[model samples]
Target: MYETYTTVIGTVVSDPRHRQTSTGEPVISFRVACNSRRIDKRTQEWIDGPTLYLTVSCWRRLLTGVSQAVAKGRPVIAHGQIKTNEYVTADGERRADLEMTATAVGLDLSRCVVSFEGAPGREPSVAGTTTRPVGSEVEGAGADAQTPTAA
Candidate 1:
C-alpha cells in the first residue's frame, strides 16, 4: 500500500487533545494553521496569504512530548502520512478534513529558540565529535517533553 507523506510548518491553533484509540492506545491530536506573510513594498505593510489548516495526530511514543510541548498558537513543524478524513456531519452534510498521523513533530526553530535536554541516564556527546547521526533519536525522546525556553 502507498502512503502519502507531508511536512507542515505552522502554528498550533488549538490545545493538544489526549485521547485513546478504540484499542486503548494513547493518541494526541491538535490543529495546525499554515500561512505566509510578506511585507508589501508599496504599502510598507505586511500582506497575509490564505491559511491551510490540518489536524495532526501523534501516537504511541509521540503522545507524551507533544502533549506537553505545544499549546494554542505555538509554532511547530509536523511531518507524517497525509490523509483526507471524510464523514457525515450531525447536520446531515458530508465534510472532509485534512489530517496527518505524525511520525515526527517539533518546534519551528526558525520562529523560536530551543534548548536540548537529553533523557535521563543518556551520555552527552563529546565536544567536536558525533555519537550518532542527527535525528537518530526517534526511538528516544523526540520532543524532550520539557517545554523549551525561548532566548
Candidate 2:
C-alpha cells in the first residue's frame, strides 16, 4: 500500500556484482557505506558519527551503466525504495539486511570530480527512430543534443 524511498550518499564499499537473472534479465548489486558527521558548535570541529551500510541493486538497462561506473571506494549517490530482508541465523539469532532496489545511482560530484563517458555498445539512431545511443549528439536535434567526449 505504501513504499519507503531513500537517497544514500556514501562511498561504494564493494565492487559491483553484475549477473543475469534466471529469466535472463541483467542486474547489478553493490554495497555502500554512509557515515554521519557533525560539527561541534562550541569547538567548531568536525566529528565522525556512526556509519550505516546498505546494499543497492540496479536492474535491467540500468545494470550496464551501474556496473561500469561504480567501483569500490568511489563516492556515489543512490536512490531507491528501501526493503528489509529478515532472517534467522544458524545460532537462532534474528538479523536484518537493509537493501535498496535502486532506481538511480551516480557519482557524488560534490566529493570528487568525474568525467562522463558514453555507454559502450550503444547503437547509433537513424532518422524517425526514437531510440538514441546513451550519449550521442544528433545534428539539429535541438538544444538538448549533447556531444560525447572521451574521458
Candidate 3:
C-alpha cells in the first residue's frame, strides 16, 4: 500500500535516536508534539486538545538532514506517510505506535531559528530546498489521511 503523510510544525519532544536495522539500514527516529485549538461552542472560547504525538523516522538523505539540522526541543515540520505499527511486548501486551516514515523533514524557521551544517562555499536553506507544502497533493499519491482501512 502507498500512502503520503504530513505533520504540523511542532517541537521535538524527545531526543532523536539513531539505529541500524537487521539489514544494516541507518535510521533516525524522533517524537514531535503538536497541539490544536478549537472554540468551545457554549463557552465561546478556544481550548486545546490533547497534543498529537507523532514519531518521525528519517532515512538516507533525510536521515542526514535531520541529524545535521534537528535536535530535541527544536521546531520542525515533517512530511511523509503515517505508519501504524502493531507489536506484542515482552509482557504479552499488544501495542500500537503511530509513526511517520518521513520523506521530508526540516527546521521550522518561522518562530525559532536553527543553524544548518555549513560546508565550504555552501549555506543550507530549508525553505525552498527542503520540502513541498502539504497543500500540494500529488495525484495518485494516496495519503494516510485518505486511505481506507479495516478498523
Candidate 4:
C-alpha cells in the first residue's frame, strides 16, 4: 500500500537529543512546531490553527549537521516521510505518536542566527564548513548557515 505525505517548515520546539546506537552509529532526535494563522470570516480576525508537532530523526552523516545548525526555537525546513510510531508502556499499554524520518533538514536562516556545534575530536573546520561554533550567535545568516567548504 502507498501512503501520502506533506512537508512542513517551522521552528525547533526542543533541543536535539543525541544518542549512540548499540552498533555505535549516531542519531539525533528533536521536535518542530509549525503554527498557522487563519482569518475567521465571521469573527473577521486571525485565529490560530492546530499546531503541528513532528518528531524528527536524523542519522549517520546528517546527524552532526542537524545538531550544529538546528536548535530550540530556530526556524528550519524539514522534508521527509511521515508516519505514526507505536510503543508499549511498562504496564503493557499501547502508545502512539507521530514522527518524521527527515531526509533533509536545514536552518531557515532568513532572519535568524547561525551556529556550529563542535563535537569532541571532530572540529567544525574539518567538516570544511565555516561556522561560528554552536553557542556563538551570528545574526542575519543568508542561507544554509555559512557556505560549506569543498569536500
The clash numbers for all candidates, in the given order, read: 0, 0, 1, 1
Ranking by lDDT: 1, 2, 4, 3
lDDT of 1 by residue, 1-151 (tens): 6799999999889888888889998888999999999999999999999999999999987776676566677678999999999999999999999999999998776676454444468853222111222333434445444332321
Worst 10 residues of 2 by lDDT: 124-133
**lDDT by residue (tens digit), candidate 4, 22-138:** 998888989999989899999999998989888998886777677656678677788888899899999999998889888888766564444444666976532333433343454
Mark the regions of model 3 whose C-alpha exceeds 4 Å error after superposition: 38-46, 115-151
Q: Give the TM-score of candidate 2.
A: 0.72
Spell out the clash pairs found in candidate 3: 5-80
Off by over 4 Å in 2: 117-151
RMSD of 1: 9.0
Q: Give the TM-score of candidate 4.
A: 0.68
The CA lDDT at 135 in model 3 is 40
In order, candidate lDDTs are: 0.76, 0.75, 0.72, 0.73
Worst 10 contiguous positions by lDDT, candidate 4:
126-135
- Evaluated at residue 141, the lDDT of candidate 3 is 55
Q: For model 3, how does the per-residue alpha-carbon lDDT over 1-151 read when each residue is reduced to its tens digit?
A: 8685666678789889999999999999999998878999999999998898889998997876677567787778888888788999999999998889888887776644333233568765433232223344447854323322111
Clash pairs for candidate 4:
116-134
lDDT, candidate 2, at 112: 55
Is 2 or 3 the stronger prediction by lDDT?
A: 2
